[model samples]
Target: MISYNIFTLTNGLRVIHIPNNSDVAYCGFAVDAGTRDESENQEGMAHFVEHMIFKGTEKRHAWHILNRMERVGGELNAYTNKEETVVYSSFLKEDFERAAELLTDIVFHSTFPQQEIEKEVEVILDEIQSYKDDPSELIFDDFEELLFPSHPLGKNILGKPELLRKFKSNNAKEFTSKLYRTTNMIFFVQGNIDIKKVKRVIGKLTNDIPLLPTYKIRCKPLPYLPIKKILSKETHQAHIMIGSRGYDAYNDKRTGLYLLNNMLGGPGMNSRLNVSLREKRGLVYNVEANLTSYTDTGVFCIYFGCDIHDIDRCISITEKELKKLRDNKLSSSQLDAAKKQIIGQIGVASDNFENNALDISKSFLHYNKVEQPESIFKRIELLNSETLLDVANEMFSEDYLSTLIYK
Candidate 1:
């Protein structure tokens, strides 16, 4: 039910705006570059650049960048993933120009001073250490390493400390110059602003960016091999992850798998995994399923933390649930209920203007158009129980699924 506008600047940066009556505005850039784009030697450069971007720019110091929006009661933030990097902000609607200009400055004009790089690397090293301390969290990265094997997609987004220390300002600048082309970026805004004004503001500032040719091509991961691994770690509870390579973003069956994943172990308390593992049996504290689909491949995983004594029981129960989905089609009432649950969840999530803005930016970046909620709902509605069963059988087959455990 949301509406938006999109246009391309002469510099090739695409812009999208979602009209709303809210007093707060959300704006940012979604660059079609991320961890996977880095060369082997580059390692953590993408994420390092994200942190240093706000440290200093041509016109502003780190302190100035931090206070520019806060002085106006706004917030700025950015994150990098396997395939994309997003820099965004939330501020009062009237300060749209201020937020947009600041985002532009940080993304394109950041100086990435050595002082900032040295300080930030220490911070990130601490972050990497903290991540290692949490098995439940670190297990996901290990699971991805198993899924993608030696490929860049499998490497942790937080690069190694040794490589991180070697990164210089020139390395970051070169990476950005090579990958962050105007054609590979999208400026997204959500608020009560006019699209024409957004076009004018972004167009004038970005006009100086030379039109550059797109040169990045992502190499897909090798054929998946189902591998089972258990690593010993000192922890109070055993963490388990089991899943397989799944349908990519472009697959027609992706929607069906999404619904199936929701019914099995989504956030809802009534999910089959939660009901069977937690509410009924009291076997574990939490259980959840996650599906991450990228440009050319996807990862579908279920993670649960349980006592060492309960690990086998938990795995058996999880496999049993997967078997149920693969062996039996949902009844009409069950299918309808599953569809409603996910649709309602999506509807609730769409109310967050910030997330919606970021989502549309990525959508436009990948698919070149924003799909309305109604459109997504229609696709979900078109999915049938047989389709869900087929996807479950294919994606959840024992031969395809891999298991990783931290004990």
Candidate 2:
């Protein structure tokens, strides 16, 4: 069992602390701002700021930050997504305070030094170039642009190269000042620790954050169209992605969608997509589907790669199977298997330190409280064949946006 509590600090920062009996300690700050909050010209500033935060802070150099944490056997990292930016650290329970202070310092005190910012910009540019080289990454980004043509949801998290070229030290500093304010941040700590102490530390750390304009931005819906895009790339296999908009992260029906995704392609060995496409017909090398849940909107996608000659056949077969789920009845045994798979995955997630943080923190952000993990199990257990069919029909409903990219 986990003991947890949450409180709003005097500075308007919400902090959630989860206490474990184990020796490992982990903490993170989830900032409720990301690409969706960016201006058209500042597309990837959230991600860029995450990189820049580690470059240097007002009191410590980059190497000093690394060395100090390393001395205590602590690990620190940060990441930016479409809706949030998370900076996290892990260390022995004895080193929790040091780890927390270092994380807070980097995120709250980054100076965005002129020399370091120049070097980091080049690094991000090269990272963007590297993604362009990887067809899998490029195709998904293309699929998103294809699916949501006019929305920021479609924009790449890595801001466009041309816009990034114009960014300098001052631009990053200004953006960070505006984006990383205290009101938009939530501090989360999970491990063997005192709840009162956790609250005290966070309150003390964020007390002086300067006030700024609200960071929350309402996510706009995607304009789905019956359009197809094919990018010509010289590669051995054609990487194809088919996707459409789906439900929001907080939607009640998401659990059903999770079960549906598993039945379609995520049941591992027994999944229909893999069994029929890869094993029976042998038309493609591999097949998979994903439901990416986000703050205000979500996406359901099926992706695969095949020999150039097999592209058309692969797409046709994939569509047929997707439609089949809508048209056919799911047997009780099949539904049971999918439920088991999802439950097992959730069970694994329950014990994971980082994922536990993700599960609780995400629930708090989305539902305004952490959902008991058992509640999910009970929901899945109650899923009958009839309910399964209903969910499948609703998920693969008539409205869908598709994107395809090939060599």
C-alpha RMSD values across all candidates: 0.9, 1.9
* TM-scores of all candidate predictions against the true structure: 0.99, 0.94
Q: What is the TM-score of candidate 2?
A: 0.94
Q: What is the C-alpha lDDT of each candidate?
A: 0.92, 0.79
List model 2 lDDT by residue over 293-395, tens digit each: 8766788888888889888888778778878878877787877777888899878867778778866776665455777768889988887767667766766
| Tens-digit lDDT string for candidate 1 (1-407) | 77888888888888888999999999999999999998889888888888889999998999999999999899999999999999999999999999999999998898999899899999999999999998989999899999998888998998999999999999989999888788888889999998888988999888888999878978989999999999999788999999998889999999999999999899999999999999999998999999999989999999999999999999999999999999999999999999999999999998787888888888999999988899899999999988888898899998999999988
Task: Specify the poorest-scoring 10-residue window by lDDT in model 1.
Answer: 1-10
RMSD of 1: 0.9
Best candidate per TM-score, number? Answer: 1
